[model samples]
Target: MAVIPVALAGRSYEVRVGSGLLADVAGQCGKLLRKQRVPIVTDSNVAGLWRDTVATSLEAAGKEPRWLVLDPGEGAKSWRVLERVMDWLLDEEVERGDHILALGGGVIGDLTGFAASIMKRGCGFVQLPTTLLAQVDSSVGGKTAINTSAGKNLVGAFHQPGLVLADLATLDTLPVRETRAGYAEVIKYGILGDRAFFDWCETEGPKVMAGDKAAQDYAVTESVKAKARIVAEDERETTGARALLNLGHTFGHALEAETGFSDRLLHGEGVALGMVLAARYSARRGYISEADGERVVAAIGASGLPISIAALGMDADGRKLANHMLHDKKMDSGTLPFVLLRGVGEAFLDKQVALDDIAHFLDEQLKTA
Candidate 1:
């Protein structure tokens, strides 16, 4: 097991990533939870795979397990769902100091954390991220929210968890597509700022995908370390340091939103395609060579991720896509800030991009398609 600390002063937490860690979850989380009435909040699907083991572990540790099973999937991350969870917690007489145990993927963590943070003003929680996407990214960052009509994560808070337990065993149950989609996040750490790490990913990522334990541990450890360093430097995204983490998020979010944030486009697929587009755009502006853009495409393609707009059957002109971008939450001073790459391992946010110029470039890109 490898433990990486996400340093945020009083609200700091440790992310533990390893295979077979679920059996030890209660022992690991005992520090943050009470001996009695520890609520295990998971969606119905995860409840089947893990609830018993988690309950047994907590019971062995002297904590009685109380469960609040939610319906699985992204649709569960809504105000209506949260209201039901809050009502259940209240009926169970959960206290301010008690914690809600988030035991699923990003959807569960985001929804549960948002509820814990707002219920009775504030409460503690633990994260047991069961998917690779959650393990290497969402579970540790403390960015919690439910989707809104405006956009993804439009209504959320920075409520950090007490701890995160990422059990690799859970990943074994993931469909290959889900595993491939999660790898985009693993690649994000490399693209954001580490050339050497990017090289490592190219070398070892296949084994990680093949279920090699050591490779999985290394990837999760390194990704968590990169995110922790950035979060410690800019915990609330006040500085552009934290903003750098949104490397492909601008275009990705726009695509996800345009798809009505449906299963038709998973966030990671959008991010993979977004990263490729950013590199292509950067190459267009002469920041990076076109050859470098090709490399980005190849990398994402090797991971079985989407690397082009056409892959989504998106024949829409760039103007149509740009309009979707205008609704992006990253807008500042009435202009959207895009995270563009100068090259691999290098990214910078641009706020001065002209919408008409973007439309023109995208229009040109449409012809090549």
Candidate 2:
């Protein structure tokens, strides 16, 4: 097991990455499970695969696992489902001191964490992220959110988890497509900050997708460590340091909106293509060479993730797509800050970006072969 600490001043927590963390849930969470009735929020899919393991663990520790299983998918992160989760948590008589377990992917973690954040003006929650995307990215960050009509993650808060158990064993049951989607975030860490790690990914990314345990361990642990350092430095994203984590998110969210935030493009998939766009846009702005941009595209595409917006077959044109970004939460004073690449490992936030130029660039991409 690799333990990475997200070193926030007073609310610091550990993100434990390993196998059987879920099976050892009681021990992993320890005193965080304060009550006999432990409230857990998860999706039905995760419940089907992990409910028994978690239940048995807590039961063995003389704790009763109370579950609120939600319908699986992005829809669960909406205001309606959030209300349901809040009502259910209230019914369970949860207290601010007690920790609620978020036992699924990013959606579960985000929604549960948001509920906990506003619950009684802030409660504790543990993240047991089942998906690779969650383990490597969303689970560690305090940025919890739900998608609104305006855009993805438009409604949320920065509620940190008390503990995060990223059990590698859970990936065994993840669909291949899901695993590949998660790899996008995994590679993202390398692309944004570590050139050597990016080089390593160019070779070992395949091993990770192939179920190589060692590769998976290294990938998850390293990604967590990278995120932990940044989160420790800037927990609230007030500093531009933390915004580097949004390397692909701005463009990705727009693509997500165009796709109706459905199965047509998973969040990670959108991010994958978004990074490609960011890289290409960076090259167009003379920040990086054209070869380097294609290199980003190649690495993402090699991992079976989409690397082109043209391939999405969307009816929306560039202007329509760029208009979607108008609702982006990152927009400040009518200017949206974009995370663009200076090189493979160098990402900087550019606040001078014009939506009109982005529309033109996206239009060119939409016509790409």
Best by TM-score: 2
Clashing pairs in 2: none
User: What TM value does model 1 have?
Assistant: 0.96
Give the least accurate 10-residue stretch of model 2, judged by summed lDDT. 3-12
Tens digits of per-residue lDDT, candidate 1, 152-234, equal: 88788999888888898998888777787788999988887997888888888887778887888888889989998998999
lDDT of 1 at 89: 81
Instruction: Please tell me which predicted candidate would have the highest lDDT against the true structure.
Output: 2
Give the Å shift of residue 155 in candidate 1.
0.1
- Quantify how close model 2 is to the true structure by its C-alpha RMSD in Å: 0.6
lDDT of 2: 0.94
Off by over 4 Å in 2: none
